[model samples]
Structure formats: C-alpha cells, structure tokens
Target: MIDTKELIDSGDLELYVCGALPANRAQEIAQISKQHPEVLEEIISIENAYQRLAAGLAPDHNDETYAKLEAIIGAKNKVVKSPSSWSPYIGWAAAGLLLIASGYFYNANNETNEEIVQIEQQKEFLETENIEIESINSQYASTLQVLSDPETVKVNLAGQAGFESSNAVAFYNNEKNVTYIDIQGLPEVPENMVYQLWSLTLDPLTPTSLGTLPIEKESYNELLRIDNAYDTQAFGITLEEAGGADAPTLERLYTLGVIDKG
Candidate 1:
C-alpha cells in the first residue's frame, strides 16, 4: 500500500500513461499492480483524467487558424503580382487587429479592478457604521438602566463661594457601587487645567482623590461615568493641574455638596 501511494505521488502513473516510463520500471510497476488492486485503479483513473483533458483542449487549427491563413495566402498569390508587397500588408492588418484587441482587454481589466476596489471600500465603511451603531445601542441601554433605578442616590453639587454659578450633579448607585457625573452645569475647562473629584470625610476634614473628570465625554444621556466611594460623607469638584492634585485646593473649589443619608 505504501509503495502504491508513493508511485502515484511520484508521478510514475502519469509517466506510465504517456508511455514515457523506462521498460524496466514499467515492468516492475506492472508486477506491483497485479499484486495490488488499488494501484491498478489509481493508474486507470489518472489515464482517464488525462484523456478527457486532452480531448477537451484538442486544437482546432485545421478549421479556425490554418484554414483562414491558407485562404488569405491563396487570395494574395492569385491577385497580387509581387508576393512580398501583399504579404506585408496582410501581416500589418493582422498586427493592427491584435493591437486593438489587446488595448480593449487591458482597459476592461483595469475597469474590473477599479470596481473591485470600490466594493471593498464600501464594505469597510459599512462595517465601521455597524460597529458605531452597536456602541450607541450599548450606551443607551446602560444609561436607561441607571436612570430607572429607584435606590440610586442623586446629589447636586452647588457652586462654591467664588464660583457661584458653576455646578454639577453626581449619581451614585448603592448596590452596584458606581458613580456617574452630569457636567452640563459646569463651565468650560481650561486647556491646561482639569476638574478633580473628591470623596470627603467631614470629621477631622479628610479628602481622598477619586480621579479627574474628563472634559470631553458624555454618553447617550449627557452623563459621564466616574469613580465611586462607599462611605463618602460628601463629594467635591475643584480646578486642578493636568493630572489632578493630592488634596483639593481650598480656593479653587468649584462645587461642594454634603450627601444626606436620609
């Protein structure tokens, strides 16, 4: 079985069908095939396949190519006095026709390639649009869930002494332990400055830096998600340097609010 498979893979079968195999190798294969039915069957299949292929691609030179050239030559010989003069004209006409066909084929191929490139670009655009739609749907689902929760704590941070009109609201979920901030009431943040959030403890007056609020993002419902603190006594927003400060600047406090447990 191994020998038969090797013979088939090594192209010995094709050589055998074409009568190109040496007599000694051919005799050895004949003996091996008599002992193995599979080998004989493989050789038969290869021969049949080659025969069919040859038949399908058989040349039609007699009727198509040779016949046309013969007729043209006969006409030139009978009508023209000098063979050289008429022959050159016939050759030039054939060359001209061939050049025109080549040009048409080249242009058609380029147009096909352009259409394929356009289709691929449109496919990529559609995929990007679909991803954006999925992201929008996911954001809306999250915002709706947060808003509908009854146990959610909503705290309005009023403007501090100096910044009387600038304000914002923070929504904290007790069970999920997450917080969302609404920045619509806050003023525009300066390029070099950012707003920092704090979770404060009134007794002894301690503040833990929650993180800085992003100036740029508010999802579906104009709500920007932020950090959460479980035992927070109050929440505050202050103008700080790029990254944020360790402690809130007393004078730069923008909004302050005490969380009412009741």
Candidate 2:
C-alpha cells in the first residue's frame, strides 16, 4: 500500500521516529500511516527500533549525583563533569564510528556488484566462442567423411578451350544425390556475370542448369554443396549473366570434365 518498502528503505520512517523529520513532514507521515495498514506497521517497527537504540544509548540519569555535581561546579574553582558535557562527546564518537563502518560496507557492496557484472560478461563471451569452435569442428568432421568415402567420386574439371588457366574439382555422391564443388582453382567472375554448372548428356549434348555459383564466395578451399541427382555424362561450367542462363553459353564455357562410365 503506497510502497511501504520504498518509504522504509528511504529512511523517512527512521527520520520520523527520531524526530529528525520537520514538524509538517512528520504530521503528514502520521496522517498517511493512519490510512495505510503497511505504513502503520512500518511506523511502529521504526518506533520500536528507535526505542531499543535509545534505551541502549541513553545516559544514566542520577539526580543525586547531578545535584552533587551542580553543587561542586557552583563553587567556581572545583573540577566536576556535569554529565551533559561528556554525553555529547560520547554520542558524536558513536555516530562517527557508525558513519565510517557504513561507508566501508557501501563501497564494498558496489565493488562486488561491478565484479559480478564483469564475470557475467566474460562467461557470455566464452560461451559464444565455444559454440563457434564446436560448429567449425562439426563442419570439419563432415568434410572428412566426404573425403574419406571410397564411393565418393572425385571428378577433375579442367579448363576448357578459351579458359586454359581455370580449373575446379567436383565431389559427387550418387547414393546421397549430393555434389560439393571446390572452385578454388577458378578465377573470380567478372561483375554482373556468374558461374553456372550443368549436368550434361553428351549423346544429346543437352546441358541442364544445376545452379548459379556464389559470387561473394567463402574461403575458396571450402566446398559448396548442391542437391543434384542427374545421371550426368559430363559436368561443365559456363560464365553467364548474373542470375545464370536457362542453357549453357558454349562461347563462355570455362571448364568441362567427362565421367567415364566404363
């Protein structure tokens, strides 16, 4: 009700009980506490705490000793502590010690919170790095499987008529109907042009488009997989307009390799 916890934590309740709050503010708190159950409980709790502190700290008030001290002090040249003089010093000392201890704990708590935040950030960063490394390892394991399989056919596609310097290797798994093309040996395609692969049937000399190659390529050494299951007599690549052509552009054929079905 009206955030009793907030009011208590704000030290307003303590100030009210100690009479440290101004008269108008204290009266306002009293009025609010009368209307709110939680606020009333909190005010009672603060009053109880104040009573306990006051009981422990209140100086022993002995009227007979104070009367004797007053009599001694009245005789101008006598030494006597009137209790009032020493009580103020004791209260100030206690307050100073409490302030120092509170300051130390406040600084320690802030530093501990900062360290916890820093540790959490480091944990997140390490977890992200570990995930990336695991992903890379899984990729390497799959690549090894493809390279190690005897059924995996490695076809070397050499440079064609005009492009004598370019070459690429095609790894095909007929059982899986998958092909991983290694295009590292091939040069970069010109802007607005793309490399297209074809599954060719030499008897009919038909060239069926497999797909367009990625222009902004990854590391050339990495193989790019394609899902193709054609009974290809030959694998050929051609440079075509960016999105690739419906048929192979023979004039721009860059590489060709025949699969000897012996």
Candidate 3:
C-alpha cells in the first residue's frame, strides 16, 4: 500500500491542484486518487483553500474603466486634410506627427500597465507573508500565556530506555480542560509511524488515548493542543502505527511522566 501521509507531505497534492504538475504525473495522481480516497480529499482541500484565497484577494474591476481602456487601445488616429492649396503637405505633416505621438503614448501606456501589474503582484505577496507572520506570532503569544499562567500545571516527560535523549512537556489547564503538549525536544517521527499521547491513571494503570500527532511540517516543535478532562495522574507518549492504536503500545513507549501531587 502507498504511504498516503508521505505523498501528502511531499506537496504533490498542492501542485496537482494548481495544475502545475506535468501530464503524466497528473495522470498518475488521478489514478492513485482512485485507489486512495485520502489523496483525493487532500486535492479537494487544496483547491478549496486556493479558491478562498483567490476570492479574498481578487481586485474589483469597474465596467466603465474597463471600457475606457479598451477604447484607448482600439481607437485609430485620424488626420483630417485641410481643403486649401497646401492641403497635401499639411495633411501629411499632421498625419506624421499624430502617428509619432500615438506610438509614443501607446508604448508609455503599456509600460505603465506592466509596472502596475508588477506592483500589485508584489503587494499581494507581501500581504500573504504578513498574514502568515501574524498567525505564527499569535500562536506563540497564546502558548506563552498558557505557560506563564499560575493555574496551568506543567509536566515534564522524560525519555524512556533506548530513547534517553527524547523529551516532551505537557501544559495542563484544569479549568479549561485543555492540555498542550510541546514536543520540541522529541526527535522527528518516522514517516510510517505517529506519536500518540496518553493520559494515565496510576491506581489501576488505566490509559486514555489523546489522538495521534499531525504529520505536517508546521506541526513539528509546535504546541499541540488536545482536549483532556481526564483526572490524569501521569502522561505518556508512545510511537504507534500511522493511524494510531486503540491502546498504548508498551514496548514502543518513548516518554513517561508522573504528575507531582505536592
């Protein structure tokens, strides 16, 4: 079976949606999409995202202004002849001057249009970049607030045997019933596997799954928020199959931590 996660992360789906992939490659993607429903879903998502962005960024055009531009570009210059003895020379001279002026203005207008297009493109690019920066900054600010809050409980998960260097932190908010796990110290997860968080109860050694970590570039080292209302006394992270297992795999456990009651 093809690794759908790997294919999605490879960015081929985005290229396919943008119609940037070559014919053969696009055909291959189409064939694969039939075999893998997830790939087809990703392609649709990319197309929807692009459509939303285009709708938000598209400039409005005025019909009157458009018509004026068409008129200016399509109108032909005419030089009327004077009904006098020197009509021939005067008409020729006037026509020559008119032609020269028209050519100059036409070239200047085209240059101006090109400049306007370039400026608009640059402005759009900068706006997109600014939005991304603001989003990242907002996330960082939120995470910092949670970390600094007095009521938030911070648990440190130490690496397990054979994975002594790996570590992760969980910020638990009792009031909000939310837990944000910071996996910055953890190594990159293997493509075929995923990292799953578990909330543990010490009395009977019960474990509750908290879903699998997302396998995206932006998700790496980022604070992942999980909804947790469980009365967890301990937390553990384990490496599991792509879709995650119903229960924690004991042997594949990477990190474990016990909440301090004192």
Candidate 4:
C-alpha cells in the first residue's frame, strides 16, 4: 500500500488526479496500479476518507434557518426597487448628453466664424482691386483732356491721291511745346518700316522730322506725344524706316496737311 500523504505531495499524483499529467505519465501510472492491486486499493481508500471527513465537518442548516435568510434577502430587494436609489445614474446620463450638445455647438460656431473671416478677406481684396481700377481711369481722363483742348492746333493729314481714305490728325499745343497725333486711320506699315511725322515750313518747302510712331494695332488709335514745338505751315506723315527718319522721304509720303498754326 502507498502512503496517501507521500503520494499527494509527489506532485505527479496531483497532476494525474487533475487530468494535467502527460498521456505517457498517465498510462505509466495506470499500468503500475493495474499490475500492483495494492496501489489502486490505497487510491480508492484515500478518496473515500476525504469525502467522509468533509461530510462530518459541514455545519447543519435547518429549514427554519434557511427561511430567515430568505426573508432578509427579500427585504434587501425591496429597498433596491425604490426610485431614489437610481437618481444619480439618471443625472449622469443627462450630464453626458448636455456635454455632447455643447461640444457640437462649439464646433459649429468656430466653423461659422472661420467662414465669416474668409468672406471679409475676400471683400477687402476686391475693394483694393477696385481702387486700382479707379486710379487708372482718372489718369486716362486727364490725358484725354490734353489731346482735345481748343487752344491746341488741329492739323488733318489727308491721304494722298494714290493712297486715298488713309487719314490722321495732329493736335499741337504751342504753349506746351507738344503735339499729340491720332494715327488711327493709317494702315499698317510694311515689315521693317514705321510711320514718321514731319513739320513742314511752306516758304522753302522744308521738312523737319518729328518722331516715329510706335507700332501696334491699337497704338495708332491712341494719342501720341511729340517732342518739339513749331511755327510750321504744314504737317506731313510718311512710311519710313523703323527707329526714326533722317529728313523726309517725299516719294513715300502717305498723308500731308496744311496746318494753320494760328
């Protein structure tokens, strides 16, 4: 027979009883108990002894004792059923909902403020662009006045016989010592060539070079500023070489005018 105390302390017997031992170890122990009947008898005897000892140590509980315990449990359940015990939980739930609403409102307000700031910035930018446009309009108005003044002498350069319908006007201001020419009616010059203006003195038929007109489709329609003042009798324009003209090319004169520089 195996000592029960020694077998339990071996750890192997405890693992075997708990079904935690390896299959090989369990088979070995089973084979030994089968071959030695004394080991199996001792195992059965130890189990029966433990069961009997547990039954003897338990305290006796009568029906009257159980009834009293059940009554106490039923009373505790009645207290838990009262509504006042649940008030704190309800308060916490309401507080959670309010916090969520406040968070949503705060985010929405921030988004609205951001949109307003962007609109204000756009308005400011548009206003600045408007001011620049207005300033440019004012400058153009002042320049137009200088070209249309009555005291300014007007010279109409009519197209020559071969080049009919090509006309231009020159506004000369003697006091300002400047001439503004409107070459809108003139045709485009051939490549590598430009239009040149001249002041002609009728007595000796002298031609003096004024200046070359800048080339572009709309430049001819705009007012041109000329440098020199004149007491000339006529104004003339011709298609000359680009840059400027040296004297006047009479054969290439496209338009001419008799100016009454009074």
Per-residue C-alpha lDDT of model 3 across residues 8-39, encoded as one tens digit per residue? 99999999988999999997787678657899
For each of the candidates, the C-alpha root-mean-square deviation to the true structure, in angstroms, is: 29.1, 31.8, 15.9, 45.9
Residue-wise lDDT of candidate 2 within 27-119, one digit each (tens)?
768756754678889889878887898799978876778668767788332233322233334457777757765765666666667667767
Candidate 1 local distance difference test against the native: 0.77
Q: What's the CA RMSD of model 1 in angstroms?
A: 29.1
* Whole-model lDDT, model 4: 0.73
Please give the CA lDDT of all the candidate structures.
0.77, 0.79, 0.82, 0.73
Q: 125-171 in candidate 1: lDDT tens per residue?
A: 99999999999899878977886798678888999999998777888
In terms of lDDT, the poorest run of 10 residues in model 2 is: 76-85
The CA lDDT at 245 in model 3 is 92
Cα error, candidate 4, residue 200 (Å)? 1.8
In terms of lDDT, model 2 sits at 0.79
lDDT per residue, candidate 4, 14-93, as tens digits? 46655688999886566445535666676566557666888899888667766577687873221111122333444577
Residue clash pairs of candidate 1 = none
Give the CA lDDT, 0 to 100, for residue 41 in model 1.
Answer: 95
Off by over 4 Å in 1: 1-98, 215-222, 260-262
TM-scores, each model vs. reference:
0.56, 0.60, 0.63, 0.50
